[model samples]
Target: MIYDLLVIGGGINGAGIARDAAGRGAKVLLVEKDDLAQHTSSSSTKLVHGGLRYLEHYEFRLVRESLIERERLLAIAPHIIWPLRFVLPHDKGLRPKWLLRLGLFLYDHIGGRKLLPPTRTVDLRQPPHGAFLEDRLTRGFEYSDCWVEDARLVALNCMDARERGADIRSQTECAALIRKADSWTATLRSSAGTQQIEARAVVNAAGPWVDAVLGQSTPDKPHENLRLVKGSHLIFNRLYDGDHAYIFQNGDGRIVFAIPYERDYTLVGTTDQSFSGDPSGIAISDEESLYLCDAVNEYLKHDVSPGDAVWSYAGVRPLYDDKSSSNSTVTRDYVFELDKEGGAPILSIFGGKITTYRKLAEHALHKLGGFADRSWTADEALPGGDIGASQFAGFLAEAKQRYGWFPADGVHRLARAYGTRIDRILGDATCLDDLGACMGGDLYAAELEYLVLEEFVIKPEDALWRRSKLGLHLDRHAHARVADWFAARKEYA
Candidate 1:
């Protein structure tokens, strides 16, 4: 079949583009070389916020766009995205109080703020702050942002795209691109085999491999547009007691975040280091681990070391090389390189944060010109997001009552993970037996079945890590059971 568009990469950008294009009535094919969000998209700081520090870089446009998209994304996918408050303590050095206040004011008003509360000043000597922070810190500002299940956001976009008639293929590599005068032929390889497909246009949203994919299409050109900056995070057992997160400033001008994660852990992270190696199987480096620990130690009274971390993860950001001297100063804003030079058009994406993905997708399509009928994904809800923008809590409350037979915590987890679609998993089950064997904690065979059928989950890691963070919560035996379940099911099939 000749498709309208062939989108390469299954990260947030690729998925978002596929979803938006498909919703506009285009026949789209989205292919990922590996599992969706297995790279940079999943390895994010996992916040949907205007980059507050970007104000210092004078990236006013990027911040405003991100701020605007932040609320839109929250409205469209409230279950996976919701409000989060961050406490930025006013340290004596670092950024001055007046400057911080001015930046916060811009962050609040620039995007026509609504739905979320405005920033407020707080006394660090009081309850939550006093107990968690150091005695030297006396004041801080609490500002609003949103948290995201980063991988799930990518999955939902792919699912929605598939529902809208886009052919979503994971573990499929676009090995070759041969652009014709009127169409482009793509060589796609997978476990099944290799095949050639035709598309009117191609989108190279291959995050870190954008240069590699671009190289495939144009062999003569040396593609060095990407600067692979590795960012790593450490997961510790609940560093502080409050639901709110802390943003700490270092003497070297970098900021680190300590956020509540997965109901039981504190997620601290993200060091900016220049990476020259392969972007696969990346993990937190010792230097990054110590850097993060030191950054946290400078702010929180309870000091921690790299040994205190329960888990660590890393991903390389495919940032556009703006000739910036420092990795941290590299622009988080996206840049698109549209080439209609040789024959058919191929648009390659570079450097964007998760907060502005929706707008990036919209703008990507706009750059591609007549690939769609109309722009429709902005206001429309992604799959399972129809539980009104502001109504997730109500949805969860009602779900707990409806599935009162199930564990309350399980119901809450499912409600947040699947939104109104939780009913599809529970599905008239009067008791636990009807849901099938419990693989671990609240994980049941029923949810697995739904993931396989609806969310494109094929392997155990896809289920435990990307589709959900069950890997962190479930025990090693439970992990084994999940692996066994997949193995047995494959054998039976």
Candidate 2:
């Protein structure tokens, strides 16, 4: 059987393409070398936001499209994507106040924002927003962006694609591609074995490995299309009380975000350093960690050191090489290289942010015209995201009311992780005891079963870390227990 679309890379772009193609009545097969979203997708700043900083680089189109997608994503997946107000504390040394104000004004209007509130001025000397900031910072501006469960976005997209008759394979690498006159034959290798699959078209959404994947098909055609920029993030114990996130402006014309994460930790990040090394298991460098700490210390009242970070992550962005002198100045917008000179078309994706992934999928499919039907993902809810178009607060209230027997905190976690599918996991369980053995933290047996049976969660890391961040909540013993559970399970064998 020939798939209509074969998508490589299991990040946001690949999953989004698979979901879009499958929903549009095309037979799609998506193969991920590692676990889904094990790298870039899971390691993002985790915001469905417009590139507010991209305005300085004159990326109006990207910003507008991102803002628009932010709204669309919020409606489709309110459980995972919701509004987050960002507090940008005004620093006298960095960007001028006038420039910040002007940028916020354009941000408010440019993307056709209606549901989210516009930007507002705040006095940093006052309570909530500015209470954690240093005394030197007196004023700031607040604007709206949405936070996303980045890995789950990829997972749910794959789930929806599978439900729509697409073959989703994790831990499967596309080793070779032989472009035929009418089709492309791909050799997919996994621990189980190598399997050759044929597809009418191929979408190379291989984030940092875009060139490598293309090189497999056209080894002689040298392509220097990606500018790999390493971005590192640190996770510290919760910094402040408020839910509002901070976007700090640095002296070096860059911005770092400190977001509320996992309900117990504060997520601080992202240094843009040029990286040329391999993209797997990338860890935060000492210099990058110190830079992040210093960047946040400049604005916050409480200073943090490298030792204070409990966890840190690094991801390499395969940005389109725009030949900008500095790494930070590279475009966040995506570019596609569609090659169809002698055989079946292959679209190679480069340089995209999490916010615009859905739209990026649409554009990618549109580029590979005649392979599938019209766009359908703009309105369709993701697999577990069909909790009506109602507000998240309303959905939470409904979940609490329906599952009154379950612990409120547990239900809340499930709601956030599985969304409407929480019911599917809970099933007929009327009490906590019905949830089978508690593996660790909120990691219950029933939830693990759902992840294994429904989502493609094969390893303990797949469940405890990527699919859900229960790893942060679980202790060393609990993590080991979960690992043992996976070891004994037949699925692991």
Number of clashing residue pairs, candidate 2: 0
Per-model CA lDDT versus the true structure = 0.93, 0.90
Candidate 2 residue-wise lDDT, 1-493, digit = tens: 8888999999999999999888889899999999999989998899999889989999999999998998999889988888899999898878989999999999999999987999999998888755688998998999999899999999999999999999999999999999999999999999999889899899999999999999998777979989999999999999988899999999888899999999999999889999987899789999999999999999888999999999988999889999999999989899999999899999999999999999999899999997555878888998778875456678888899999988789889989888889888998888888988888666778888889889999999999889888888899998888887777776555
Please report, as a residue range, the 10-residue window in candidate 2 with the lowest summed lDDT: 383-392
Q: Which regions in candidate 1 have their CA more than 4 angstroms from the true location?
A: none
Candidate 1 clashes: the total is 0
lDDT of 1: 0.93
Residue range 1-493, candidate 1, lDDT tens digits: 8999999999999999999999889999999999999999999999999999999999999999999999999999999999999999999978999999999999999999999999999999999789878999999999999999999999999999999899999999999999899789999999999999999999999998998899999788778789999999999999888899999999999999999999999999789999987898999989999999999999888899999999999999999999999999999999999999878899999999999999899899999898655768778997789987789989999999999999999998998899978989999899999999899999999999899899988899999999999999999999999998889888997
Q: TM-scores for all candidates? A: 0.99, 0.98
Q: How many residue pairs clash in each candidate?
A: 0, 0
The best candidate in terms of TM-score: 1
Residue 461 lDDT in model 2?
96
